[model samples]
Target: MPQLDDGSESVEMSVAMLRRMAEQGVGAVCATSHYYRQQNSIETFCARRADALDRLLVNLPEGLPRILPAAEVAFFSGISEKPDLGRLCIQGTRTLMLEMPFSDWTDLQVEEVSALVLDRGFSVVLVHPERFCSSKGNRQKLRQLEELPVSLQVNAGTLLHWMDRRVGLNLLREAPIPLLGSDCHNLTTRPPNLKEGRKIVIQKLGSAFLDKMDENAADLTRQTANATT
Candidate 1:
């Protein structure tokens, strides 16, 4: 339920957008704005995200899916060692949606994921492996990631051939990609069409795979609630 909003700039989120998302059967969405150290500090990004969430909530129509504040933190060196980085995890959950670098991952980068999982007890959900795992070597690296307690998330638009369809389909067929995100940005560009993605998923992997994905999402939501309480 993580929605990737335009982080570098101000974008309008309307009731129509939420209504469209609701129509797609989305119960809730995490407003995961991009967090890159080069662009802005964590504090500044968080403050902006909070402000945006407050503004959106004030004008939210009745019966629309709730929006939770979060950040899709950009992976960096020594991130696992940064103590305060946990504050950027999805609101109350231990889950962090990590947007991996476009280049091939280094050993230290891979080790950071392990540290985040085993030492810090965080659920590291890697976003859009299809983008990075374009080669056999990269796919092998993805398999290495699977060996850990990490989860993989694919964008719904990718499945619909909006992005690289071949890579997306390759990951869907081969990888244990459990989470399917709409990665919704705005109403015009990347609209929420999870229903379409779900149909594609069901068509390819069957209803059982969709059921398992739902269970995983529910478990993450439960974990978030428990952490808040």
Candidate 2:
């Protein structure tokens, strides 16, 4: 899968980087967000975020990764709150790249978010679930999560950064074919590019798997774009 960070950088920065990477041959991107105002609720953030997206959409580069409105949305207080996720956004496709809290959560909390997504007629795509506080014990919980309508998104950084080889492999082994993403942001330490991440998948999972992942990503992104109307 093409590893890409959710575009949380400023619109100009993100656009420039995305345009540059596309010129360099980047395939797809999963624009994700992690920042949430501690003072303001999701409702407030949603309004501002949507306005920002609306402005950005008015002038995007002609050919960029099917920028999906995805999020590293955290499960706050066991509540998977839904902000104003517009249809054009990737997460608006009833596919939230849900992020669990940094600490462990009860199985009930996991179920709550998963069920909330499905109940809302949307799908949940768990994001880098291996990094959660319950990384060890959460396997069984995640296994149950798979039973629902959800997909797993593994962070390419996990492999590229060598933060946890076993976890990445174990997730690959256990979770359904995961969608790979870079989770990149900024031009410095986190320059936007999927080249290195794609290389790791080719080396570890074979080129065939890599191709299929790319195909799936393309298909989903197209579907996301079509949903914009």
Using lDDT as the measure, which candidate wins? 1
Cα-based lDDT at residue 84, candidate 1: 66
Best by TM-score: 1
Off by over 4 Å in 2: 1-9, 35-43, 54-61, 78-92, 133-135, 219-229
Error of 1 at 16 (Å): 2.3
lDDT of 1 by residue, 1-229 (tens): 2222452233245567778889888898766778887887777777767777776677677899877666788998888887567667778888888998888887778888888889878888888788887666667777887888677888888888845765665665554538888887767788887899999889878999888888777665554544421
TM-scores for all candidates: the values are 0.88, 0.76
**lDDT tens string, model 2, 1-229?**
1222244456777677777678657765666656343544556655555666676677677878555555556666534444344331364354555676666668778768765656555556677776862466676677777777566677777767676856775675565546777666777776754677778878888888778777656544554433322
| Residue 178 in model 2: lDDT | 64
What are the lDDT scores of the predictions, listed in order? 0.75, 0.62
Candidate 2 local lDDT, residue 213: 71
Q: What is the C-alpha RMSD of each candidate to the true structure, in Å?
A: 3.1, 4.7
